[model samples]
Target: MSLLNLAWHSLWARRGTALLSLLTIALSVALLLGVENLRTQAKSSFASTISGTDLIVGARSGPTQLLLYSVFRIGNATNNISWDSYQQITQQPTVKWAIPISLGDSHRGYRVMGTTNSFFEHYQYANKQPLRFAQGRALENTYDVVLGAEVARKLQYHLGDKIVVAHGLAAVSFVNHEHYPFVVSGILQPTGTPVDRSVITSLAGIEAIHLPPQQQAYSEQQLTPSSITAMMLGTQSKLQIFSLQRQINEYKGEALLAILPGVALQELWGILSIAESALLAVSICVVITGLMSMLSTLMVSLKERRREMAILRSVGAKPRHIFGLLLLEALLLSVLGALLGLLSMYLILAAAKPLLLSQFGFYLVLTWPSLQQLYLLLAVVIVGFIAGVLPAWRAYRYSLSDGMSIRI
Candidate 1:
């Protein structure tokens, strides 16, 4: 029989221990690759959440805080930007278009944003892609509201369904504007971004809900909000972006912050880098532990294989052949383990795609292993070969007399 066939028979004889060792390596590789997938995709998601807009102008606050509130809807603004400030800034020669964002209310757990028709027309995501509607049309009246894909799906809302807005971010609120419910007019297409969780309404709808009750009728002139949470500004020229940002920062009317979304995203990632590194380190340690387990299995099986080695020697098999056989077993086990690990990873990702996109608005592209992942697989094979060196040497050194006679 060939060396490979001999190696296969030897492993099959010790299948229980070999299987356990293989599983350890497989689980370890899955964990390492999973961590890498999350890290790279998270950065890409955050960067593409909002694109095309040149600046995010919000109430004076830390750049990261502003970005988190304005774009991600993670937190509330420290203060509101007055309508006067929004108008004056947008009037600048360099300001090409602006989208106002007024926030404070919620329906269920989803945030409510008050914006203009400008938002539907100008807002972009995922490489300057325009927002698309999956149902109905944009806001046409003060009482009309648009639903994000997730919001509509989770709430089972459709056009003309009236939803009551609550005063705060809590899922269950006691102070609901039950008297000022808005009818759903449209549902936005899923963009796999944070916007999927937002409930959109016109600026007039927000203003009317908070205003004192009377003959509750609002017109286009009265649609102007008293203050807004933030403004996304687009500049006419890329060259004028810096100049416009500086101008907004130095404005005297109100304390306002203007931040480039890209810069804020980088800073946010920098803040999160430590946690990401720690996760990666832990994954590497797990992979090493798995390799160590395989080594231990090989070491223990050595003593049991002494009689088998004696028979091979009697058959005129050289010490070099014995060494090569042991090496081949280890290589085969690792290669199988890596393949199993890759299959498990893809299955997990496939199952998680819908949940991630719906709940977190995070979309992970399901693709074949990346170059970096391939490198990791290559590294595992190299380490597996190195792990076989000790056992291969020991097996080669065994003498024919060692196991020719049975021990009592």
Candidate 2:
């Protein structure tokens, strides 16, 4: 028989034990690869969400907190910087562009941000990639609103549709901006960032929505926005970032804070690193257990195959040939199991892509494995080869003893 056919038959000869071992290996491979892929993607997506930005200026607090609130929308801004300070910083010779952000409102659970038209022109994500509109232009009027890709898909919002805003970021809002309703003017393309899960409007629109306390007397007055949550500043020169930040920090006019976006992002990742590492460690332990199970099952099956080895030896089969047979069986099993596991992972990720994208703006790119993943697969294959060595060694030892008369 051909070597391939021989290996196939040998594996099928112990089909019950072999199938169980194969399954164990498949499970382990899937968990290891799946966890690694997710971890790598999450880190990359988080880091790439804001690129080409020099610094993020916000209220005085931890850098991580500033990034979390400004870029990721993970938490509320601790305080609001006055609109006057925002204007002062933007007029500097070193300042190129500034996008002011006003938060503290929501449609359903998605955040509502009021920013300038410069945001669409200047904001970048996924490695300095500019925002692209799937439909219509950026919001210009006080009542025009733009929906992010995820926000549109999840809430089933359409261009020209009118939606009311909640006073606070609440999923089930009771207090509403009943006076000023927003018309969906545009929908943004997927950016794989928090922007995809947000609603964007003009800073003026934000100003018009929340009127000053006295305007509440004319409760029927048209939208008149006043305050905002935070602002994003862009600079003309890279070297001027620190000096500008210092200027905002020392502003005696108002209590404020200015942070560098890159620094804040690093600190944010550092704070989240602990939880992520813990999850990976747990997944690794599970994978190790699965691998051990496969190894033990393979080793135990050798007892029943001892008689088969003896019969082959009695027929004058060489020790090396018998060892090759055992090794070939393991190689085939590992390859088949690995292939199946990879296929399953791909299918699962495919099905979950839309949901994940719309819910968190975390797009799972279904591309070929990166170099790191390739290296991981290579390590798995090497481990499989080593796993087969012991079984092959046992067969070799048996063949050396049995000399053409032994059937036991």
Candidate 3:
């Protein structure tokens, strides 16, 4: 029989033990590749959360903090900007549009955002993709509210449902605006961004809910907004962004800060890169452990196969042939495990995608393995060959007498 056929038959004889080692390697590879896939896709998701807008203007504070509050909805603003300042900025010749945001209230744990029609009109994400309505229309009246996809789905709310707003941004609040309940007029489509988790309403709607019972009866035009939490600015020219940002920062009237969304996002990711590295390190360790287990199994099997090796030598097989056969067996196992690992990763991701989208608004795109993953597979094979060397050498050193005699 040929060397390849001999190696194949030998592996088949020990298929039970070989299968366990293959499974261990397979699971380790799956975990390693899964971590890499999530890290890459998550960074892409976060960077594309808010796009098309030139700058995020907010109360003077740390750039990271402002990004967290305005874009991610993770925290509250330190201060509010005067409506007069908002008007002044919007009226500038370089400015094309401004969407004012007033945040402070919540509806059943989800944040309530107070903004104008421009928010739905000009806001863009994932390469300037416009927001689409899954149902109903934008806020036409002060009390007409809009619901995000996640907000509606989680609360099981539909259009025309009356919902009360809370005074604070908490899941459960004692102070509720029972008298000024809002009617859900619109529901936005899922964008896999923070927008999916927000409750949108008109600026007048926000002011009305917070006003005294007597003031709630006033028309939207009569109830002027005193301050806004932040503003998303779109400039006429990309070149003017730095000039506009500098002007907003140096305004003499009130404390304000302007940040380029891309820059702030990069800085935020830099802080998170450390955690990504640690995850990769742990995965690498797991893969090494799996390889070691495969090596141990192969070494133990060498003892049982000594008689077979002796028979092959009697038929004129060289010691190097014995070495090559053991090496080839290890390579076959590693290659099979890597392929199985990739398959397992894709299946798990497909199953978890919907739950992740609904619960966290994170969209994980399914794609083929990246070049890095290919490199990792290649590394596994190389390591497997190296791991087989010790056992192969032991087989090579065995004399014909060692396996030929049966000790009683």
Instruction: Give the RMSD in angstroms, all C-alphas superposed, for model 3.
Output: 1.7
Which pairs clash in the backbone of model 2?
207-224, 207-225, 207-226, 208-224, 208-225, 209-225
TM-score for all models, in order of appearance: 0.96, 0.90, 0.96
In the range 311-385, model 3's lDDT, one tens digit per residue, is: 777777888888898888888888988899889989888999999998889989999899998999889879977
For candidate 2, what is the lDDT? Answer: 0.78
Compared with the true structure, model 2 gives a TM-score of 0.90
**Model 2 ranges off by over 4 Å:** 1-5, 212-227, 400-408
Tens digits of per-residue lDDT, candidate 2, 1-408, equal: 765687898878778877887777777767767777887899999889898777777777777777878888879877887767777777889889888888888888888988878889899987789999999888777789999998898889999999988878779989888788899999999888998988998766766667753464432224433445667778888888899889888988777788877777777788889998898788667656655666676678776677777777666667888888877887787777777667766777788887877655778888887787667666666677677888789778766765554445
Once model 2 is optimally superposed onto the true structure by TM-score, how far is the C-alpha of residue 79 displaced, in angstroms? 1.4
Which residue segments of model 3 deviate by more than 4 Å? Answer: 219-222, 399-408
Instruction: Give residue 112's lDDT in candidate 2 (0 to 100).
Output: 90
lDDT of 3: 0.90
Residue 55, candidate 3: C-alpha displacement in angstroms: 0.5
